[model samples]
Target: MRKLALSDEILLKIEKPARYIGNEVNSVIKDKSKVDIRFVMCFPDVYEIGMSHLGIQILYDMFNRREDVWCERVYSPWIDLDKIMREEKLPLFALESQDPIKEFDFLGITIQYEMCYTNILQILDLSGMALKACERKEEDPIVIGGGPCTYNPEPLAEFFDLFYIGEGETVYDELLDTYKENRKAGGTKKDFLEKAAGIEGIYVPSLYTVTYKEDGTIDTFAPSSSHAPAVIKKQVVMDVTDTYYPESPVVPFIKATQDRVVLEIQRGCIRGCRFCQAGMIYRPTRERNVEKLKAYARNMLKSTGHEEISLSSLSSSDYSQLEELVTFLIEEFKEKGINISLPSLRIDAFSLDVMGKVQDIRKSSLTFAPEAGSQRMRNVINKGLTEEDIINGAGQAFEGGWSKVKLYFMLGLPTETKEDMKEIAVLADKVARRYYEIPKEQRNGKCQITASSSFFIPKPFTPFQWARMYTNEEYIARAAIVKHAFQDQLNRKSLKYNWHDAEVTVLEGVFARGDRRTGKVIEEAYRLGCLYDSWTETFDNDKWMQAFENTGIDIGFYNLRERSLDEKFPWDFIDTGVTKEFLIQEWKRAMNGEVTPNCRQRCSGCGVAKWKGGVCVESKN
Candidate 1:
C-alpha cells in the first residue's frame, strides 16, 4: 500500500466527504515509530451512521487514552463509493491517516445487528482481506467483533478470529495489556487469540467445534481446549458512574441514526419484556450518578454545540434517579441554550413528568410501545402493561399538552388472534379520545396519533425463542382486521396507521434467528443487489425470496415454523448470561398467561447475577 493523497476530484465522488476527511477535534493520530499497536475500529456501515454510534466513540477514546495503542476509524463505503474504489483499484483505508486497514495490527468491528452480517463480508472484501478467519495468514490483521449481536456469533463464527462477549470496558483493558506484552515478545496472532480466550469475556471461536444434527440444528458444541469454558461469562460494568466515556461525542454534520449528543444515563433494562432481545441481553441496569450525568451533559453541550441532548438508555424513565438527573440537566443547561430529549420512555404517567420538564421548549411527539393491543395479549407476551396503563398514559400526555402521540406495537406475537388484532384499533381509538377530553384553551392542537405495528420476529435468548412468526397471509389478514376496525371509528379520524412490510419482516425473522445454512440467503441476496437491507430502498423481498428458493431452503422453516422445546436452537451455545432454564420458565409462564415478578422485585436468577458478582440490581443500603 502506498501513502494516499486526498484529492478534491475524488472527494467530490464519494458520499459524505466529511467521513473520509477525518479532522475531528479529538481524533487520534499516532507516530508509527512510537505506537506499538494500531487498531482499525471498523464499523461495517457508512461513516455518517457509524460515527453516530457511541460504542465506537467509547472504545476509540478508551484505547487512544493509552500512549502505546492508536485506534482509527473505518466504515464500509456506500455502493457508489465502493464502485469508484473498485474502478480506482483502491483498498480499504482508515480515515485518520489514509493508511490501508491491513497496516493495522488489530481490526475490531462491532456486530450491532444481524443485518450487518453481509456488510461485514462486504467490508472485508473491500478491505482486500480474507472473508474467512482461517484463510488469513499471520500477516493479516487479527479481526474481532463485539456488541449485542456477538451474543449469537455462531452464524458469523467463521468470519472473526475472536469476539468480546459482553461489556468491552471491563476486560478490554486486560486484553490490550496482554496483547502489548505478547506483541513485545513477538507473539503470533494465534498466540494472542489463544491467550485472549482465557480472559473472562473474550471468546475465541476457533477453539470450539459446532456439530449440527440432521435437522440442521446444533447437536453439540464441544470445546477442543480446556481454555474454553462451558459457559462463557458476559462482562458487566456494575458501576457505570465511574466508567470512561466521552462527554463530548463527535457531532456529525449530516443527520444520522442519532446525530445529536447522546448522554447514556444508564445501561440495560429490568422490565423483561419477553419478546425484547435487548432487555434480556443488556441485563442488570446501571445508571450514571445524577451529578456526574449532569456534568457530562453540560460539558457535551458546550463542546458539541448540539441543540438537543438526548438522555439515552434502554428505558430512560426506569432509572431510579431520572427525575433528579433530568431536573438537574434542565436547570443547569437551560440558561446555556440546551434542550433535553429522552430517546426511550416507559408508558407511565409518572414517566411523563420527566418529559414534562422539557415539554415547553422541546415539544416532540410522544412515543410509547404498548407492544400488544388487548390485555390478555399483553399478558401472554409479558409486556406487563395493561390497556388502562397505555390509555391513561396517553390521557396524561394529552392533558400535559402533547398534541401528537406515536404508539408502537407488533402484530405477529405468539398467541395472536383476529380478536386481539381488532383491539389494536380499539386501543388507538382510546388514545385518540383522550386528546378531545382536553380543554380547548389548554389543548395544544389537533391530536395526531400515529400507530405503527410491526411483524414479530422470534429472537434467541428471549422467552419467545421457540415461538413461530405469523405467515404472510396470516399477517395480511390480521392487518386487514385492525385496519378495517379503525377505518370507520369517529375518534380514529386523527389516527394514522403505519405497518411494517410483512415480506421484509418475514425475511428479517429468517435471518435474525436462522443458522449458518441461511447464510446462503444473505450471500445470494447481496449478490443479487440486496446491499443495505437495513434501509427500505435496498431491502428487496423478491431478491430474498429468490435467494431462499435458489438455496433450496424453505424460508418458512426459519421464520414461520415452530420449534419443540427439546430442539436445539441456532444460538443455544452462545451464552448471553441468561440460563436456558430461566428463559424456558418465562416462556412457560407467558404461555400460561402468568406474569412473573420483575428481576428487581425477586431474583429470577437470569445468570447476570453470577457475572455481575451478585444481584443484577444494586440494593439501596
Candidate 2:
C-alpha cells in the first residue's frame, strides 16, 4: 500500500488536497529498493498548470520506461498549501512514492517560461534543498533544468547543477548510464558531473566561466574544465517518428488547464517568424509519421479515457499529412463522441472546412494572429500574412457561421511607430466589417471582434534578440493609442481591445536576455516573498523592483538598449545549429521589411541543413 505524504489534518486545511495526493490513473509506481535511480520531475508551477505541459509528460513516460529508474512527479505548491507546509515543517515530496525530493538521485525541472524563475527557488526552498547549487551537500539531488527557457540558462545557472540543452529524447540515456556507472565506481558528485558534461547537449555551468566587458557585454565565455566543451551543441532528435511519446500519461485527479490527450504531430516550424524563439531554435522542422500519430491518439484516448485529443505542433497547417490524419480521426472516433482539437492552424479555406466538422460554430470563435498590424510590419516579422488574408479568412468564418472572432497582435515590436500601433485597431475594424458584409437576415446576429495585444520581449536566439524593449509606461502608451483608435473606428461597438500587463512584460524581457548577474536579483526577489510571479493576482511589481535595487542590477542594461551586431550575447556559447551569420542576415532583412520564404518554398541556408534530415532534406529531395 502506498502511503500519503500529507496528514489528514493538513490535507483538509488545503484548498485542493487532490493535488498533493498520488495514485492518479496510469501513474507509475515501483519498489524504492529495486530501482537504481530515483528521479523527481518538476514543472515548478501549480498542479493544474504543470499537468497540462506535454513536455514533462513525454519525459516522465520516457524516464520511467527504464527498469532501473523510478520517475516521480512534483509541482510547486500553491500559496495556501505552501504556507501550511512551512508552518508544519513538512518537506516537499514527490507524488508517486510520497518521498522527499531531497532523497532522489535527480531533480529535473522543465522551465517553459521566464516568469517561473522565482517559483524555481520556491521549489528548492520547500524541498529542504539549497537554493544555490554551490551550497548543496554531497547527498543532495543533482538539479537539472531543461525546456525552451534553458537556451538562456545564465540567469538560473547558479540554481541549476546542470542544464540539458535541446531535446531530452536524444542523449538522456547516456547521461543516466554515466551517472549509474560513476556511482558504482564510488565517484564523487563533481566527478559524475564532469563525465556528464562530456556528453552532447549537457551544460554544467559550474565548469564554465563568464567574463564581462566594461560595457557589461560578455567579453568571454569559456570552460574551465577539459570535460566541459566550450561550445555545447544542441541535441536534435532527427527521427522524431521513432522517438518515445507518452501514450498512457498520468491523468490528474482534478481538472487541468488542458484536460485532453495531446498528440504532437511535429517538432519545429517551417515559417521563420523573426520574433519567435521556438521557430528559430527548433530549426529544420521534423514531422512524425501520420500512421504512428493515429495509433498514439487511439492508444492515448483509450489509456486515459480522455474525451478530447489535441494535435500539438508549432504550426499544424505545415504538417504535410494533416488532412489525411484529421479525416482518419473523424471517421474513427467521431461516432464515439471524441473531440478533435487542432491548434496552431493557419486561417484558410481548408482549415475552416476542417474546423467546421469538429467544432460547434455557435459556441466556437475563430482566432487569427496577425502578429503585426500593417502589411509592412507583417513583412518585417516575416508573418507572411496580409490585410487581404485577414479580411478573407474572417469573411469565410462568418459565412461558415462563426459570429465571434478573436484577433491577436503584439505591441513594442522592433521599429514600431504610432501608425503601426493604431493599425491594430484598423485591422480589427476591418475584420469586423467583413462579418457585417453579410445580409442581416443571413447573419448569426452582431459579430463580436475582441482584439488582444501583448508587449514583445527580445528573446535569445531569435532574429529580434538584439531588439530594444520599451519601458512599462511606454508599452501602456502604445496600448492607449490602439484603444483610442478603436473608439474612432466606424464599428467601435462591435470591437473590443485588451492588452497584457506592461509590468510583467518588462520583467520578462529582463529575464529572457539576462546573464549570470541577474541570478542575484532573482534570489533577492524570492527572499522578498515573490512566488508565482506569472499569476496576475500574486505578481507584485514593487517587490521585483526592490529586488533589482537590492542587487544593484539595472533593468535598463538588459532590456532598454539595442545590441550591436558584433556584441557577444551570453547565449553565444550554446550552438543551436542556426548560425549567427544567418541570424544577422535575417535581422538585416527584417530591417528592410523583406519577407523570407518558408522552408517549403526555398532554402535560405540558415545552417540547419547540416543535420541532413527533416524539412531541409525534404526540400533538397
Candidate 3:
C-alpha cells in the first residue's frame, strides 16, 4: 500500500480531505519496480475539476493498460493545502502511489484553457522541477503539453519541451514505444525529443526558432535542426468506435464538478459557428456507434455505480442517432434510478419531448445557445439560430411546462453593434413574454430567464482569428449596455443578467493569439507569484500587466489590433486538416452576413474530408 503523504492532523485542516486520499474505487495501482516507465499525467487545477475532465480519464486508462507503463494522476493542491505543503516542504505527489512526482520519468500536462497558464508553473514549482524547459537537465522528467491549447502552443513553447499537437489516441503509443527504445539504447534527452519530433503530430519546440517582425507579428518560423518535421500534421482517429473506453474510472470519494458518469457521444461538431475554435480544429465530426455507446454507458454506470450519466459532445443534439441513444439509455437505466443529462439542445419538438421525459420540471432549466441577438448578427457569426427560431423554441418549451430558461451569448464579437447588444435583453424579455402568453393554469411556474455573456476571444483555426478584441474597459462597458437594457423591462424581476470578468477575458485573448515571445510574459508573471489564475480570487491583472512591461512586449500587438488577411500566424506551421483558404472564405462570408449550411445540410468543401472520413464525406440533398 502507498503511504499517505499528508499527516492525519494536516488532512483534518483542509476543506476536502478526500482530494488527497488515493484509495478511490476503480483507481489503478501497479508495482513501480515492474514498470519501465513511470508516467505522471497532471491537470493544473484542483482535484475535483481535474477528475471531471474526459481527456485525462481517457489517456489515464489508455496509458495504464500498457504492461510496461504505469501512468498516475496529479492535480495542483488547493490554496489551503498549498500553503501547508510549502511551509512543511512537501513535494508534489501523484494520487495513486502518493510518491513524489520528481521521481517519474515523464510529466505530461494537459493545457485545456489559457486561464490555467499560471497553474502550470505551480505544479512544477511544488514538484521541485525546473520551471523552464531550457533549464532542465537529463535528470528531470520530460515535460510535455497536450490538449486544445496545444493547437496553438507558441505562447507556452519555452515552458514545454515538446507538445503533442493532435488527438492522443493515434500517436501516444508510438511516442511511448520510441521513448522505451531510446532508454534501452542509453539515449539522452536530446536524442529522445529529436526522435519524438519525427512522429506525425509531435512538436519539439526547442528544435524550432521563431522570428518577429518590427510590428511584433511572426516574421519567420523555421526548423533549427534537420531532424524536425517542417509541418506537424494533426493526427485523427478515423473510427472513434474502436478507440479505448474506460468502463471503470477512478471514482472520487467526494463529489466532483461532474460527479456523474460521462458518455462521450462523439468527437467534433457539425455546426460551423464562426467564433468557435473546437468546431474548426476538430473538423469532420465523427460519432461513436450507437450500439457501442449504449454498451459503454451501461458498463461505466455499473463499474462506477454513478446514478447520473451526462452525454458529452460539442453539441449533444447534433448527434445523428441522439433520439435512439437517449431512448435506449432511458429504457435501460430508468428503473435502475440512473438519470440522464442532455446539453445544448435545440428548442424543437423532438428535443422538448426527450427533455420532458428525462428532466423534472422543478429541477431542470432548458439551455439555448443562440450565440447572438438578431438574425443579421447571428449570420455574422454563423450561429444559424434566428430570433424567430428562438421565440418559437421558447413557445414550445413554455407549452411543454419548462418555465426556466438559460441563454448564452458572446459580447465583443467582430461587427457587433449597440442594437446587437440590446437585442440580447429584447430576446430574454420575449422568452418571458412567451411564458405568460400561455394560461396561468397551464404553467409550471412563473418564468425566469437567465442571460449570461462572455467576452469573445478570437482563437486560431477559426474564422474570427483575424478579428480584433475589445479592451478590458470596453468589454465591461459593452456588457453594461445589455444589463441596462434588461433593467428597462417592466418584468425586470423575471430576468437575471450576468457577465464574465473583462480583465480575465483580455488576458485570455493575449495568450490565444500570442507567439513564442509570450512565454517570457508567462514566466515573469509566474515569478511575481501568479498561480491558479483561472480562479477569480487568484488572478492578478496588475502583475500580468507588469510582466508585459518587464518583457517590453506590447499587449495591444497580440489582442487589440486586427490582422490583415494575408498576414502570417504563429501557428501556421501546424495543420489541423482544415485549410486556411476555407477559413478565409468563411471569414468573407461572415462579413457579408451569409450563412453556410451545416455539414449534414450541405458540404462546404472544408478540406478535412481529404485526410479522414467522417460526417463531412456524405452527399447532402
Candidate 4:
C-alpha cells in the first residue's frame, strides 16, 4: 500500500481533503522501479479547476499509456494547505504515489490562463525548485509549459525551461523517446535540451536570445544554439479521429468545476472571429469521427458513471456529424437518466429542437455569444452574426419555452464607439421586446435578458494582436455607458447588465502581450501573496500594482499603445500555421469594418491549408 503524503490531522484540517489524496477511480498506478520516466503533469490551479481541464486529462491518459512512462497528477494546493505546507516546511507532492514532485523527470504545467501566472511560481517554490529556470540545477525536474497561453510565452519565459507549441497529440511521443535516448546516452540536462530543441514545436527558452529595439519592441529574436530552430513550427494532428482519448478518465473524489463526462466533438473552430485567439491558432478545424465519439461517450459514461455529458468543442454546431452524434447519444444514454449538454451551438431551428429534447426549457437558460451588438461592430470583429440572427434566434428559443436568455458581449473592442457600447443594452432590450412579441397566454413568463460584457484584451496570434487596449478607467466608463443605457430601456425590468472587472482586464492585457521583462512582476507579485488572481475574492490589485512599481515595468508599454504593422511581436519566433501576413490582412479588414467568411463559406487564404486536412480539405471531399 502507498503511504499518504499528509497526516490525517493535516488532511482533516484542509477544506477539501479529497483533493490531496490519490488513488481515485480510474487513476493509474505504476511501480516506480519499472518505469523509465516519472512524469508529473500539473494544471497550476486548485484541484477542482485542474480536474475539469480536458487537455490535462487527454495528456495524462496519453502519457500513462506508455509502459516505460509513469505519469502522475499535481495541482497547486489551496491557500489553507499552502500556508500549512510552508509553515511545516513540507514539500509539494503528486497525487498518484503521494511522492515529492522534485523526484519527477518532467514537471509539465498547462498554463490555461494569464491569471494563473503566480500560481506557477507557488508550485515551484513549494516543490523546493528554483523559481527561475536558469537558476535550477541538474537534479531539478525540467519544467515545461503548454496550452493556448504558450502562444505568447514571453511573459513567463524565464521560469519555464521549454514550451510545447501546439497540440499534445502530435509530437509528445517523439519528445519522450528523445528524452529516454538522451538519458541512456548519459546526456546532461543542457545536452538533452539542445537535442529536444531540434524537434518541431519544442522551444528551449535558454537556447534563444532576444534583443530589443530602442523603443522596447523586439528587434531580433534568434536561436543562440545551432540545434534550436529560428521558427518553431506548431505541431498539429491532421487526423484527430485516430488520436489518443481517455475512455475512462480519472474521477475526482470531490466535485470538479465540470463534474461530468466531456466528449470533445472536434478540435478548432470554423467561425473566424477577429477577436478570438483560439479561432486563429487552431486553424482548419478538425472533427472527430461520430462513430468513434459514440463509442467513447458510451465507455466514458459507463466508466465514470457521471450524471451529465457535455459536448466539448470551439463550436459544437459546426461539427458535420453533430446531428447524428447527438441523436446517438440521446438514444444510447437518455433512457439511463443521463443529461446531455451541448455548448457553443448557434441558436437555430435544429439547435433549438435538439436543445428542447435534451435540456429542460424552464430550468435551463439559453446562451448567445453574439460577441458584438450592432451590425457594424459585428462586421469589425468578423463575428459573422447580425441583429436579425440574434433576434430570430432569441425568438425561436422564447417560442421553445426558454424564458431566460444569457447574452455575452465585449465592452472595449477595437474601433468601438459610445454608440456601440449603448447598442449592447439596446440589443438586450430588443431581445426582451421580442420575447413579449408572443401573445400573453403563449409566454412562459416575463422575459429575462441578462447581458454580460468583458473588456477586450488584445491576444497574440490574432488580428487583434496589434490592437490597443483601454485603461481600467476607460473600460469601466464603457461598461457604465452600457449600464446607463440599460436603465433607459423601455423593458428595463427585464434587462440585466453585468461587466467584468476592469482592473483584472488591464492586468490580463499586460500579460497577454507582455515580453520577458514582465516575468519579474509575476515573481514579485507571487512573493507578495498574489496567488489565485483569477479568483475575484482573492485578487489583490494593489499588490500587483506594487510589483509593477517595484519592477519598473510599464503596463501601458505592453497594452495601451498600438503597434506598427511592421513591428515584430514577442511571439514572432513561433509559427501557428496561420501566417502573420494573413493576420495583417484581417487586421486591415477589421479596420475597414469588413467581414471575412468562415472556413465553410469561403477560404480567406489564412495559410493553414499547408496541413491539407480539416475544413481546408472538406470542400474537395
Candidate 5:
C-alpha cells in the first residue's frame, strides 16, 4: 500500500475523501528511479471531473506505455481540500505516488476553456512552482499548456514555458526523446526547451516577442530565438484509428461525472457552424471503424466492469456508421443488461426510432442545439437547422413517446435582432404544441420543454472571431426579450427558460481574444482570489474588474471592438491548417446569410486537408 501525505483527520473533513486518496484501481505506479522522465499530468479542476476526461486517460495510457516515462495524474483539490491544504501548508501531490509535483520533470496542463484561467494559476501556486514561467529556476518543472485554448495562448503566455499546439498524440514521442537527450547530456532547462522548440507543434512563448500598436492591436509577433519558427503549424493525427486508447482506464473509487465507458467514435465535426470554435480547430472529420469501435467498447467494458457505454463525438448523428454501431451495441449488450448511452442524436425520425429501441424516452430528454432562435439568425451562425426541421423533429419525437425536450440556443449572436430573440420562445411553444398534437394514449407524459440560452462568445479561429460582442447589460436585455416572449405564451407553464451568466461570458470573450498584455490582468486576478472563475460561487466580477482596472487594460478593446479585415490577431502566428483568408470569406458569407455546405455535402476547402487522408478525401462520408 502507498503511504498518503494527508492524514485521515484531514481526509475525513473534506467533502469527498476519495478525491485526495490515491491507489485507485488501474492507476499507474512505477519506481521513480527507473524512469527517464517523471511527468505529472495536471488537470486544473476537481478529481471527479478530471478523471472523466478521455483525453487525459488516453495520454496517460500512451505515456505510460513508454518505459522511459512515468506519468501521474493530479487535479486541483476542491475548495474544501484547498483550504485545508493551505492552512496545513501541504504542497500539492500527484495521486499515483503521493509525491510532490515540484519534484517532477514536467507538469503538462490541459487548458480546455478560457474560464479555467484562474485555476491554472492556482495549480502552479499549490504545486510550489513560480506563477510566471520566467521566474522559475532550473530545478522547477517545465510547465506545458495544451488543448483547444493553446491556439490563442498569448493571454496566458507568461505563465507557460511551452504550448503544445494541436492533437496530443502527434509529437509527444519526439518531444520526450529530445528531453531525454538533453537530460543525458546534462543540458539546462532552457537548452531542453530550445531543442524541444525545434520539434513540430511546440510553441515556446519565451522565444517569441509580441509588440502592439497604439490602438492595442497586435502589430508585430516575431520570433526572437533561432529555435522559434515564423509560423508554428498545428499537429494533426492523420490516423486516429492507430492511436493508443486505454481499455482499462484508471477507475475512481468514487463516481465521476462520466463514469461509463466512453467510446470515442470519431474526431472532428463535419457541420460548419460559423460561430463554433471546435468545428474550426478540429477540422476534417475522421471516424473509427465501426468494427473497431465495437471491439474497443466491449474490451473497455470488460476491463473496467462498466455497466454503461457512451459513444462520444462532436456530432454523433453525422457518423457514417452511427446506425450500425448502435445496432451492434443493442444486439451485443441487450441480453447482458448493459446500457447503451447515446450521444446528442438528432431528434429526427431515424434517431427517434433508434432511441425507442435503446433508451427509456421518459427518462431521457431529447436535446437539440439550434444555436440561434430564428431561421435567419441560424443562417448567420450556419447552424443549418431550420424551423421546420425543429418542429418536425419534435413532433416525431413526441409521437415516439418522448415528452421531455431540451432546446439549446445562443443569445447576443452577430446580427441578432429583437424579433430573432423572441423567436426562441416561439420555437419552444411550437414544440409544446407539437407534443399536444400526439394522441393522449400515445403520449409519455405532460410536455416539458426546457430552453437554455448561453451568451454568444466570439472565439478565435472561427467566422465570428472578428465580430463584436455585447456587454453584460446588453446580453441580459436580449435574454429578457426571450424571457418576456416565453411568459406571453399560453403554454408558458410547460416551458422553463434559463440563461447563462452574462458577466462570465464577457470575461471569457476578453480572455479568448486577448494578447500577451492580458497576462498581467489574469495574474492580478489570481492574486485577488479569483481562482475557479468557472464556478458561479467563486467567480467575483468585482475582483476581475479591479484586475482589469489595475492592469490599465480596456476590456472593451479586446471584447467589443470590431477588427478590420487587415488587422492582425495575436494568434495569427500559429497556423491551425485553416487560412485567415478562408475565415474572412466565411465571415462575409455569414453576414450575407449564406450557408456553406458541410464537409460531406461539398468541400468548402477550409484547408485542413494539407495533412492528407482523413475525411478530406473528397469522396469520404
Candidate 6:
C-alpha cells in the first residue's frame, strides 16, 4: 500500500477534501490477514455524493457481514486531484486503508448512469490497471459493475469485465463465494469468470463476441465457448422483509442528497406507467413488514439522531400498510421531534391526510406530477390518473391548509398535442380557483401554484422503447405554447412556470439508449469541459452539440428517430429477465386508454415469470 504524499495534501486543498478522507462511523474495516477475498466498492463520482447513496451502503453492509470478505470504498478523484496524481505518479487507493485498488480480489464499480463511463476509465488509469479487460493480466483484479445502468451496459462494455444485470443482494454473494472457492485451488481470473458466467444474472462480455452489420445493426452475438447462458435472468429477492439492510446508515457531516434517515419500505412499483423503466425492470413489488420497518426506524433515530425520517420507495402512498406504519412512527417519535417525509407521494386528498401527520404546518409547497395536462394525453402515456384525480387531490390539500402546490408535467410525449399544452394552463387555473374557494378560516391567502414541465425522454425496457423523443425546436415550441397559455389568463400571476433545458433532456435520451459509439461523444464532451453536467450551473449544450459532430454520429438516430419492432436496440444483447412481448402489450394498453391493475392486485404478466417460475403478484388471478 502506498502512502498519500505531500503533493496529495496540496491537491486536496483545491478540491473538496471530504471526498478523499474515508473515516465514517458505519464503514467496514477488516484484518487483511483473515480475509480470503477483498472487495473494493467504487462509485465513479466524488465520495460525498456516492457515500450518500443507500444502495452502496446496503452492499457494503451485506458483504462486510461475512468474515471471509472485506469491503472498502473508492470514488473517482476530481480533475484537480487527478492532475496531481498523474504528476506524482500515484495510484488510486481505497479510503479505508490507502491500499491500491489493483491489490483487491474484486473491483466492483457501480454504473448508476451512462455519464459516469469515462470516470470508470479514469479510475482504472489512476489505479495502475489496464483500461480494458482484455488488456489486463491474470494478476489484475476482476472488474465488475451493477445498478440501474447495468441493464444497458453496451456503451460501457469495453471497460467493465462483467455486468451484474439486476439486484445485487443475491448475485453479489454468488460471485464472491465462487471466487473464494476457485482461488483456493489456485485458478486464474479467467478461470473464475468463466465459471461465474454460469451463475444467473452475471454477464461476462468477454466470453461472448458481438459482430455488427455494415448497416449499424447487430449482425449476430455468438458465444465463443460453453461458459454462458443463452438468456441470463436477473436475480429477484422474493421477500424483502427478510433482507439485510442497515438500520442506522452513516450520517454525513455535510448535507448530501438525502439529508435525513431513510427507510426503504418497498423495493418495486406496482403501477405500470408506460415510460417508467424502473417499474418494468424492478418487477414484482416487495414490501417490508410494518412492524419490522417501525422497529428499524426507532433504531435509526436512536443511533443517528436524525431529525427527519423518510419512508422511501417508488411510491410511499401506494404501500398497503402506509397508514399503520406512519401512525406507529408518529406515535413513537413525535416527542423525539422526528418528522416523516415521503418522496413519491401520490396527489390525492387521502395523501393530504397522511402528510398532515408529519409536518406540523405545510410551510413548503406540495409537489405532484400529473405527467400530462389533458385526459387523452395522460391515457397515451399510461399515467393511470385522470385530470379529475389531480383536481380532487389539489382541492383536498388546499382545504387542509396548504398555501402552495407544485405541479409536474412533461412535454413532447407520444401522441401529445398543442391542445394538451393548453390544458395544463386550464388545470392550473382550476386548482387556483379551488384554492381560493376554501372558507376563510381554512384558507391561506395568496395561493401559490407552480407548474414545472420537462421534455419526456423515452427509456429502454419500457413501453416507450420504440418511441421517438421531441426535437429541440419541437420542445421549445411546445414549451412556449404551455407558457403563453398560462400568461393568457387575466390572473396568471397567481401561477408560476418553470422548465428544464430541452437540449439537456435530448442528450440524456441519447446516452440512455446509445451504443459503444456514444462513449466517444462522452469523452469528447468531458475533454471540452462538461464535468458535472448533472448539475445545472455547469451543463454546456454547445460543447455536447460539438462533441456529437466530432464523433460523426447523428443525435437524432438515438433520441429523435423512432425505431421499429424489427430494429435492433443497442441494449438487445443484455437480458433484464422481462420479455419484449410484455412491454409491447403495455404499449398497446397505453394507446387504448386502458389501465393495468397494480401488481399487488393483478399480475400484468411482464416476463419476469421466466425466472420467477410463477406469476408476478398481478397474474395469479
After the best TM-score superposition of candidate 3, give how far the Cα of residue 562 lies from its true spot, in angstroms: 0.4
Instruction: Show pairs that collide, candidate 3.
Output: none
> What are the per-residue Cα lDDT tens digits for candidate 3 across 340-428?
99886777999999989998977789899888877788999998887888999989998988989999989998899999999889889
Q: What is the C-alpha lDDT profile of model 6 across 262-371, one tens digit per residue?
A: 89999788787888889888887777899999888988888777899888898888788988888888788888787888789896666787787776545867888888
Better of 2 and 6 by lDDT: 2
Per-residue CA lDDT of model 2 for 105-173, tens digit only, reads: 999999999999999999999999899999999999999999999999999999999999999999999
Tens digit of per-residue lDDT, candidate 4, span 530-571: 999999989999999999999999988988899999998889
- Candidate 5: misplaced stretches above 4 Å? 611-615, 618-621
Candidate 4, RMSD to the unseen true structure: 1.1
Instruction: For each of the candidates, give the backbone clash count.
Output: 0, 0, 0, 0, 0, 3
| Candidate 5 positional error at 235, Å | 1.0
Name the better of 5 and 6 by lDDT.
Answer: 5
Q: How close is candidate 3 to the true structure, as a TM-score?
A: 0.98
TM-score of each: 0.94, 0.99, 0.98, 0.99, 0.98, 0.94
The local distance difference test score of model 6 is 0.80
Worst 10 residues of 5 by lDDT: 612-621
Q: 151-170 in candidate 1: lDDT tens per residue?
A: 77776777889988888789
Q: In model 6, which residue pairs have backbone atoms overlapping below 3 Å?
A: 602-618, 603-618, 603-619
On a 0 to 100 scale, what is the lDDT of residue 188 in model 4?
A: 92
Better by lDDT, candidate 2 or 1: 2
Of 5 and 6, the candidate ranking higher by TM-score = 5
Residues 144-222 of candidate 5 have per-residue lDDT tens digits of 9988899899999999999999998989999999998998999999998899888989999999987778877878989
RMSD of each: 2.4, 1.1, 1.4, 1.1, 1.3, 2.4
